[model samples]
Target: MMLYKLRLTFVLIAIGLNIGVQAQDFIPILKKRAYLNNSYQKLLKVTDTLKIAFIGGSITETNKGWRDQTMQWFASKYPNAKFKQINAGLSGTGSSLGVYRIDEHVLNHQPDLVFIEFAVNDYKASKHHILEAFEGMVLKIKKANPKTDICFIYTFSEAMLESYEKGFYPNSIIAMEEIASHYNISSVNFAPDIIQRIKNKTLAVIGPKQHPDSTYFSSDGVHPYENTGHLYYTQTLTKALDKLLNKGKRFNSKKDIYYSAQLEKAKMTHLETQMFNGIKAEIPPPKFSSLIQNIFALNQVEDLLQIQFKGDRIGFMDIIGPSSGTLKIKIDDQEPQYITRFDRFCSYERLHWFIIDGLAPDIQHSISISLAPNRIDKARILGKATDTEDYKKETWRVGKILMVDK
Candidate 1:
């Protein structure tokens, strides 16, 4: 009996050791490639503030998520280096929207190290739009400052697992990776890393903590719980950055031309309503509002507002809500185009880019917008209680205009 008991204990010990070894073998590690080599070196030699920009969807926008943790890691890593974290994340926006707003949201900050994460959000955007927006963003960053270092951080959502299980990266990842490779930009894909751990039976996909479940990592399978999700991101980023700090620049002189087409003509310029008319005219500011600011509200169908700027392409920086309405836009001697800001799934105050591109560059262009005679009483998904109270009768509101120059 004693011998049998001892043998059973020995077998259990062996099984545990084997499982531990398997888990260790599957431990996820990021690539050792260097990113923003010149900018990083400059940070090491200077005492000025090192601004690190985090731009992406909700994951990146969460102030407490990986953004802050990564910044903290940098602070501890470089005790003497001054670091400032710039949060340029807009929730529910993909790279296409990002390209249009990057100038106003991110480039204005002038960061030294920028992390662009849009793998999950870009899933809804077309491949063509993704390429143009992604490439446009990278090129714009380079154009803003050649020494600015950029890294494309690929994050995976729970829905993305199906494709990974089929031995394929998601479409968004595939599209963004192409651009990252062309630019020789450093990229880190954490999907496979997490997937590997799950397959190894060490990580849980869903369950209560008392049992075997890791649903706590991500509550809805897309947006991660700040603590768990952010930890995973920071771990991957800090590990890769630590490795990169010990390495030399990947390129002797980083090549500037990643793609042949510069996409420079796709730039956007923001013009406020004050540019069209003063504070007391055809457009009036909201009596009481919180979501939008410095906007010109129009209620009547005949209320016309015109803006003239020196650029080829122009777009409106406006938000949509339950009270939003349709508008007719005319650009530089062209027929009027009709646009609606209302949708079946519209409720939140989010920036919408209504743009008309492909105009003659270096020429003056005029744009006129007015409320369409027809109104849309959208079916409220969240009920009428959430409608914008002050602008219940307002049809169209112009927040700002964006013009692009070649």
Candidate 2:
């Protein structure tokens, strides 16, 4: 009987892993192989176009880490360089909620490079509150973006090397390698370089020697298995960012401390889903009997719409027509992103407004936004604009669409 219900769900998740809790320690995922074989600083600048950012917690969540093999290794080496990446990881966040949304997710997406994976849940809230919230997210992104570039990833979890020879255990990767050597920043001891590439056997097989098995990541246990961890981030983070891309000035420039670049891996599409996903809000702008119609566009034409639901969740907001795509939530018997954020007040994409994480409060649930099965990233009303802000520019223009259900 399906192998006896998968061996009774693995003996009830191995008796919920032998009932216990509190233990967290041994945080050493640090060592950045002597300043990670480096170079770069002839007036510190390297950008033919790159917006790289990963943040941390839930292992840099986005398509579940190693971000689609660092976007297929920057579209096969800067194919017209415009490789932008953003994950702002947020799943049981640490580093004190990534220093309260590091200025709305890494200084409002103005990244040049940032791959800071928090040392295993900020040493589970200690190790001096993960070095005072990671020196306040690297001194507030170097005092508000000083040519943005900061890398400090020290991700360990194979019970962080069976409590890496404990002492307060590698004090948050030796206080983040002494704050990336007092701020020259750029480091990535990715779990001891994947456990010395799995003890020199050149990587292959790991999981439950302490925890990392989901074939090494994704599905939690701290995220990554994103398509084979992007060849382990193109052989350890693009071979340490190709020895600091087209090098120049003194990096580890002190004997046995200089470098070069060579990387190949990309095709990146990591989409775990939701980070202002689409977009939505409480939507409270009409009243006094409320009814406003500002038809913008909708070429698929199912026109004439209206909706109104209040408080503790309800549904009914359809804009069925002029399909540009992505409306999700047509659940009649399931299979529709299971609509619920008390029933969606968000998911708008391009114009940005994802308030999702909802559903379940039927109100006779028939919520419809229709048409969606990929059209890139859009929420359209048939795009036929003539002026003044569009959100469905001009299609369902009869009595202007509105429905109030309490």
Candidate 3:
């Protein structure tokens, strides 16, 4: 039976690997020299009630950033222990960006501890590049401030296991575990704990049959919709912290500034998802299109004809996504006619941007842009923007959005 189980495990691993494995942030298949966030590897030591900072995406942001739970866990045990909690989590953010702001949100504060979680949202991270981003953040933290101990927590997508045979958090935990062992930093497989708990009947399944609607540790579908989920991980962190503080060591100050403007792009989930280098879900904007300009932000702006002209022509503009999108035509100084495309995308894709073709050719009579119009007239393909360096087509490189001078 043991041999049979081993054979079954081998089959499972083989099935998982056959998916033409792309480098994943949540799951590192690539045998690179080291992991992006090697918090445990640097081998640091510290003492009592260390300040702990947790950073990541929605999973991290779920319960007001998991700060409360982490603190509560310590408060219960240490009672008189000294500790600081900083939650630098923003929902919808990917690891690429979290790694960018580590200096600001994490390292600079010089906490003795940090809890990083960017695994679940790997959907929004750069395909093969997540490791570098994660690696960069951890290496930066360790190299500049080695005294700080790190915990790389892998989160999960609730619906993951239900789909065929793909389980999101397990492989990611595997990859992170590999890093933790190499660096000798403490780690936690947060998501899998709940999953395995349910398997063993120790923890009831959450949400639905495959997914739990509510967990002793989670709520909703993706983010842990409760305080308990945070508490769950906090226990693991507390144990890890005790060991690090007990050890006594410090890293020399190298002032290794490891991030850049490019890294800043990581903060934006859209950019990171594009970097996934996979057949990612195309974020299709609203179908509503016009032959002219489109504006996406209305800022308190609301519903009306997105595009209508009295002294000129009439047409519609593409309503991309929700925001305060409006169109204005000049009549005089105080009386220029204005149309606001209000909260429409609540049902449709909130059209904040518009395509306005004066059709009057009054390019001089003239048009002023509040927001760059959802304009094709101004947009042109800069070049064959794909990478020519290698045979493989690189999807990340964007087609430049250049303004065409009429």
Q: Write the per-residue lDDT of candidate 1 for residues 1-406, one digit (tens) a residue.
A: 0011111010112321121111212212343345567557756775688888888987898777888888888888888888877887767777766776677667788888888999888876666667877888887887788777788888877777666655455677667766776776777766654666567666555444344444345756777656566677677677677655543655322555544333544545534545544433332234213223456666677767787776556677666655678888888888998888776646655555566767776778787888887756654444455445633654655565554452
TM-score of each: 0.77, 0.24, 0.49
Candidate 1 stretches greater than 4 Å from native: 1-33, 197-214, 250-262, 265-268, 272-293, 308-312, 332-336, 358-366, 380-394
How do the candidates rank by lDDT, highest first?
1, 2, 3
Top candidate by TM-score = 1
Residue 5 in candidate 1, Cα distance off native in Å: 55
Query: Which ranges in model 3 have alpha carbons more than 4 Å from their true place?
Result: 1-49, 64-66, 162-184, 201-217, 236-245, 248-321, 324-372, 375-406
* Residue-level lDDT tens digits of model 3 in 105-178: 67667776677787676544333345555656666667656656666776655554442124323333434444
Worst 10 residues of 2 by lDDT: 1-10
* Best-to-worst ranking by TM-score: 1, 3, 2
TM-score (C-alpha) between model 1 and the true structure:
0.77
lDDT of each: 0.65, 0.43, 0.42
Which is the leading candidate under lDDT?
A: 1
Q: lDDT of candidate 1 vs native?
A: 0.65
